[model samples]
Each structure stands twice: as C-alpha cells, then as structure tokens.
Target: MASKKNININLKVWRQKNAKAAGSMESYKLDNVSTDSSFLEMMDQLNEQLVAEKKEPIAFDHDCREGICGMCSMYINGRAHGPDTGITTCQLHMRMFNDGDTIFVEPWRSKAFPVIKDLVVDRSAFDRIQQAGGFVSVNTSGNTIDANTIPVPKADADKAFEAAACIGCGACVATCKNGSAMLFVGAKVSQYALLPQGKVEATERVLNMVRQMDEEGFGNCTNTGACEIECPKGISLENIARMNREYLKASLIK
Candidate 1:
C-alpha cells in the first residue's frame, strides 16, 4: 500500500440563512486535504474551520454517507452529485480534483425542490409522489400466499430489481435542463409494474404517480437523456419508456 498525497484546494460554497433569505457563493480555502478523503469528509473539515472561527457552518443534507439514503444532494461544479457519474455526493472523493482546483457546491435546483438552506433542498415532493402510488396492497394475514409460489419471468424480475435500485435522489431532476423527474418516477413505477404482485393496481399506480409528479411542478421529459446519464444508480431510460407505456395503457382502459 502507498500513502495518499495531500494538497490544498479552494472551495466556492453556497450560503443561505433560510428559504426566504438570499444566497450566495462564499469562497474558502482548504489546506492539506488528503486525496483519500471522501467529499463529505472534506466538507466536515470545512465546517470545523467555520465553527472554530465562530462563523455559521455551511448546512447540507446527508445521511447514510454510504450513498443509500440519497439524502446527500449537492450540485457541484455545475453537475448534480458533484462532477462524478453513477455515484452520489458521498461517493465522490477529493482525488477527483487537482490541488489548485476551485469547486462550487450548490443545492439541487428545481421548482419542485425549493432550497431550504445552503446546499439543502426540500425533497419531500418525492415522498408525496410515492404516497400517490408507489406500493402494492398486500394482505399480511396468515392467509397470504407464499411469494415463491407465483414464478415470474427472469427478465422481468431482473428489470424490476434494477428499477428498485433507485434511491430517490433528485440528481435526475437537477441534471435535467427541464428539471424533469421522469427518470425517478419511471424507476418507481417500473419496480412494481413488472412484478405479478404489482399487476393488480398497475394501471392506477402509473396514472396516480404521474399525475402527482405533474402536480408537484416537475418539468416534462424532453428525451435529452441527461437524467439517465447523471443518475447515481444508473437507472435506465428504458424505465421511462416502460412508464410511458403503462400510462398509455391506463389512460385507454380508464
């Protein structure tokens, strides 16, 4: 094993007192940052410096720094979840930048994702969308049948699992020029639509979810494919196509 080298860098961080307050990019310098440190760890160091100086620390959202929580939302250097691809902010490393590089960190931007503070946005719209139609009504009583008894095609099963991998991070929406959430909504819809247990309410589920997504004021997908490209989970655009089909079928049947 080799010792990782350390370097100094400049940070351009967003600071906002609250949702109603004005925000701006504030510059700070960091010294001897190790390349091995995760991006969030570097942020912790920055906060430590601010607190030591009696200045209010930057506020950001993060939980389960392992990247599963999807709560660590940051737009860094004009890209969602930093400049990395297929990874969340927590997964980004200091090594990605050069010693003299200046990094800009901002919150996810969208009409649906209002900034709650510096580097933090209200993502509860996703929760509302899920509440609209993200589940299967299962009887948990003793009369419930075994899941294995109903065999599903391997292809559908794999695809459903892939769609289920979405962590509900708003990167797809942030990266989309139109601020569209089609990828996120599509993944959620596809996860259940491909499964037999989800077939019962498949029609209603897609319709309600899409309707709720629109009501939240997320922009429409224009098929530029930025959402799929920047998705941390690599959730496929195929899910979007599947969602469109489901929505069409539901519209016709209704």
Candidate 2:
C-alpha cells in the first residue's frame, strides 16, 4: 500500500564491514518516500538506489517479509524492531514514520550476539543456550499417545502457549539496558516447564539453560520490564518469575 509521495527523510544506519571492523552510523537521504512501505521495503528501495549508483548496498537480514520468522531485527528510532507493538521488523510499516523524519537503524547489540554485517548480528548464542536443554528428551519410536492421556490444566496450557510464542528475535536482549536475555530464556523455560511432555526434565532443563545463559556474558535481569514492553510477542515478566522458581527448585533438587 506504500505509494511514493513527496516526502523526504534522513537515515542514520550502522555500517560495518565485518565483525572486527569499527562500526559507525552512516547517513543517507530519501526523497519521495512511500508511507505504506514496510521498513525492510524501504531498505530495499535504498539498496536499489545504491545499486544503480554502483555503490555498496546496505546489509540487513530479512525473510518471510511477514513478522513470524523473527529474522528481521533492527533498532529503529531507539526501539527494537521499530516503534510498533506486537510486531517484528518486517511488519513495521513506513506509515509509522513522518515526512522529514530522521530514523536510526542498527543491529542487535549484545556481547553474545556479535555483529554479522551492517544491520545483522549472529544470534546463534540463543541456539547455544537452547542446546543447553530446551527440549523434551525422548527417543521417537512412532508411538502416538492419546492427547487426553496426559491431562494438562487449561491455565498451564494457555501459559505454555503464550510462552511458546516467543520467536527468539533478541528484541528483549536488544531493548534491555542490561542486555539481559532473561525474558527470552524465561519464555523458553516457561514453555517447557508448563507442558506435560517437558515436566520430566523441567528441573534439569531450567538449571542447564540458566547456567548456559549466565555463561554467555549476558547481564543479570533486574526486572525493568522493558523487555516485556518491547517484546513483539508480549511475553510477560511472569514467565521470568516462573523461571526463577523453576531454577530454585532445580538447584535445590540438584
């Protein structure tokens, strides 16, 4: 729906050639901008212009164009993904901007998430943390069990689903002043803790993942709630509380 109207804007985009390179914000200008373009689409337009001029295109990550993949992440105007609620960067529309506006875009900033490119960071730290133990450990023998065999309380199921909605986008980490991934880790913990299939390994999973999370050089969460506020999935602080309890119980058991 974005139509190129007579609008002008300024962009301050973080540019880096590689992980070891010193990064800095490079400014760009836009003219006759479309108000309905998604933020990524705007970047695409910019890339087109740069290509035509035989200049290097800005680098960023994206896929699904929709918000589900959690791949498109950018710190826009000071917020993770953008100035939007319950949406990822791909879903962030240009309509959020105004004419003659100045927009700042940057990659996720975290010690564990080293910069991969201009506006992309290697978020594989999350994968490592998950590998610590974020799954149900059971060999698949193709035995189908009745859904009713393990009766999950409605409340727990709902909470599990809510926590499961986290897309691992690292927005919580990016927005947190401490660069804490407690929200992300908490959601993962809560998702497994509340599920019947995951209950068997709940104690071990929480302890291991939390340990890996701490070892990743991320800061401790002080519960500022900025993570929940900025989370596209609206994952709650309650998940963090649940994770804390699970971790304590896990420690005691160990």
Candidate 3:
C-alpha cells in the first residue's frame, strides 16, 4: 500500500477578543498537515506556529476529542462540525480535504451561543435549558425501588437510549437557518418521555424545557430539517415531532 500524503491548506479563521469585541476572518496558511491528523490536531499545529510568531493562538472549545464530549464545535466550510456528517469537529480528519483547500472555520452562530473568544462560543444556554427540567424525581429515603425491577418495553427502551445519546454539541443550531435548538431539546424530552420512570414528569419536563429554550433566544423550529441533517449524533427529526406532541399534551394539561 502507498503511504499517506501530507497536505498544505489555507484557513480563514474568525478571531474575536471577547463577546463584546468586534470580530473578523483572518487568513493563515498551514503546511505539511498529515492526512492522519485529526482536525483539532491540525488546529494545535496552527497554534504552535502562532505561538512561535509571538501572536495569540486561536481558542476553541474541546474535550474528549474522541467525539463524546461534543465540545469541539466549528462551522467549517459552511457546515456544522466541518464538512463531515455524524461526527464532531474533533473527529474530522485532515484527509477529507485536498492540499489546496481553504477551510473556513467559525464558531457556532446563534443568539443563544454567543462567541466568547476566537472559535469558542458560550453554550451555557443549553445547560440552563436542561436545568429547567431534564430529570425525574425519585424517592430515596427507603422508598425507592430498584429500576431493574421495572419492565420497560424493548422498543421504547431502545429509543430512549438512542435519544439519550445527545451530547448537546450545538451543531443543530449552527446549521439551522433560524438558529433553532428544537432538535436538542426534543432529544432530551424524548429520552425521558419514552421511559416509565420519566412519564411522571413528562408534562412538566416538556413545558419547562421548551419554555427555557425560547427564553434562551433560540429561534423556533420551522421544520426545514436542517437540524436533523447536521446533527453529529444523527439525532432524528422524529424527536422534534415527538417533542411537539409532548408540548401540545403539556399545554392542555396546564
């Protein structure tokens, strides 16, 4: 087999001092990028070069570069989490691009996810939405029963497990024309609504979460399906429909 080739590429990265600071795209040429190197690794190389030149390095959020954290978010080549699908930015490989490719990297653009510095954005809005109601209350003082004793249908349990896989990466919002977050919220709601333990809090959970989502300044889902297409976890659009049903049921309950 032939050896992998290293490529040279250009990058147009967005730089910002802070949320209140004005920002613009700054260009840089990166050389000898190994095809085997992960996108974040190439970013590390760029930072090393910047440091050697006595300039401030780019700042991007990343943890668990293996892709589970879903923290390494970037709008690359006008796509959420880069030019790839079903993976976060950290999981993107340099091999996907050619030697002369000019990659455009920017932070997740949403009113809720304001840019913090360089490629980093403030995604705490998701945390606040989850905090409003992403859990169930269970008795613990000698009254709690073992969850294993409960019988959950395999179909519902599997869907719930799949819905639970959401990592809150904000890719859906970045890829959305309206900067909507219904996909994420819907996944969170579906994970709970599918389980018997979660049924008790279903009405309150959907109401609180949807309410907090709107309060975060995220736009409404217009059903363009962009969120489902760009979601790194492959979260389905059905969750959004399920969320809509849950929300409707909750509204009537109040």
Candidate 4:
C-alpha cells in the first residue's frame, strides 16, 4: 500500500454536457495527491482544485463508494475501472499510479447509452431492456413450495448464481470495440434461464430480451472477450455462449 504522502499527476477527462452536445477531452494538472486514496477520492481532490480556480468541476457518477453498487463507472487509461482485474472503479487505489503519470478518464461509451453529462451516460436503456422480459413472469402465489420440492442439479444452481452476480455496471459495453452488450444481456438471460422457475417462459424471455437489446442499437457480439475482461463481477463468456444456445433453441422451436 502506498502511504498518504502527496504526489503530483496529470489528468485528461472527457467532457460532454448532454447527448446533443459535442464532447471532447480536457486536461488538468494536480499536485499533493495522497497515494493511499481511492480513485474517486483522487477525483474529488481534482474537483476541489477546479472549484478554487473558478472552473467548472469535472462531473462523474458514484454512489456507495463500496464495490457493491457498481455505480462508479470510469474508463481509466484505456481500461474500464482502471487497470485492475475483477474490481470496480471504487476499489481502484491511487497507489497503482506513479508521480507525474498521465491518466485518461472517460464515461461508458455505447450508442444504447448516450451521454447525460461529462462522465455520466444514460444507462437506463439497460433497465428498459430488463423490463422487456428479463425475468420470469410467474406471480408469487401464497402457495409456498418447499426448497426440496424441486431438486435442481448443483451445477445448474451454481451457474445460475454466477450469472445472477451481474451488476449492470456497463463496463462490458464501454470496453467492447463494437459497444455490444451481449455479456450484460446474456448474464440476465442465463440467470433466469437456468432456473426451473424461469424455464417455463424461457423461449419468450430470450426472444424478447435479445430483440429489445437489438432495438436499443447495441452492436452485435463478435466474441472479442473484452466484456468478460473488463467486467468487475467477473461474469463469464460461458454465460454468453449459454444465451446463444438458448436463443437458437427458442428460434428453432418457435
């Protein structure tokens, strides 16, 4: 761990006001940064400096500060969530950087996700895709079934849990060269599709979700594997293969 000692660094951040506004990258210099601070904390120090200089502060979205919320979305130095593996941006520490280093930070970039502000893009399109049938439609009746009523294979259960871990952070989208969202959509599909409860509407769920994903203008997946690499939750490409299989089966059956 790096100490709380101060260091100086260079920052290049992308700025955009709204979807209609043309965006560009802007640079700033900072000094006396604590090496032990988290990435967001470093950004806070930069914002404070800009404020003191009467300049518009750089805008970025963050919540919970913990790794759980998946709200800290940043493309740092050409990698989503910085250069760390299996960690969210909030978990990224300034210690990874050296004094006088130049860092480039940007928002999630995808046609489905348009810019809302400087480092904030509209990601509600994912929510809309989810609403388009990302879940099992069975209403919860008062009749509670025992857990043992259905003996799910442990393998299936484990796979379902893995898929369900997707945090919908949009890193997969940003890191993708084509900006495809197969990983995100695939995780949701695999999460429910593997479960018996979701098997009932499996065909409809896969069909509707993929269709909506396409309608959102996200590019097609070419299996570049950038998504799986950048995913903070470490979602697998296997889930995407599962989704591909499910979609094929549904299309053929229907």
All candidates: TM-score: 0.97, 0.96, 0.97, 0.94
RMSD of 4: 1.7
What 10-residue stretch in candidate 3 is worst by lDDT?
Answer: 1-10
- Residues 1-254, candidate 1: write the lDDT tens digits: 11448878899998999999999999999988888899999999999999999999999999999989899999999999887799999999988888778999989999999999999999999999999999999888889998889999999999999999999999999999999999999999999999999999999999999999999999999999999989999999999999999999999999
| Model 3 C-alpha lDDT versus the unseen true structure | 0.93
Best by lDDT: 1
Candidate 3: residue 173 lDDT (0-100): 93
- Report backbone clashes per prediction: 0, 0, 0, 0
Q: Report how far residue 54 has shifted in candidate 3, in Å.
A: 0.8
CA lDDT of each candidate?
A: 0.93, 0.90, 0.93, 0.90
Q: Which stretches of candidate 4 lie over 4 Å from their true place?
A: 1-4, 141-149
**lDDT tens digits, residue span 157-219, model 3:** 999988999999999999999999999999999999999999999999999999999999999
Query: How many pairs in model 4 have backbone atoms within 3 A of each other, for residues 3 or more apart or on separate chains, i.e. clashes?
Result: 0
Instruction: List ranges where model 2 is wrong by over 4 Å.
Output: 1-6, 144-148
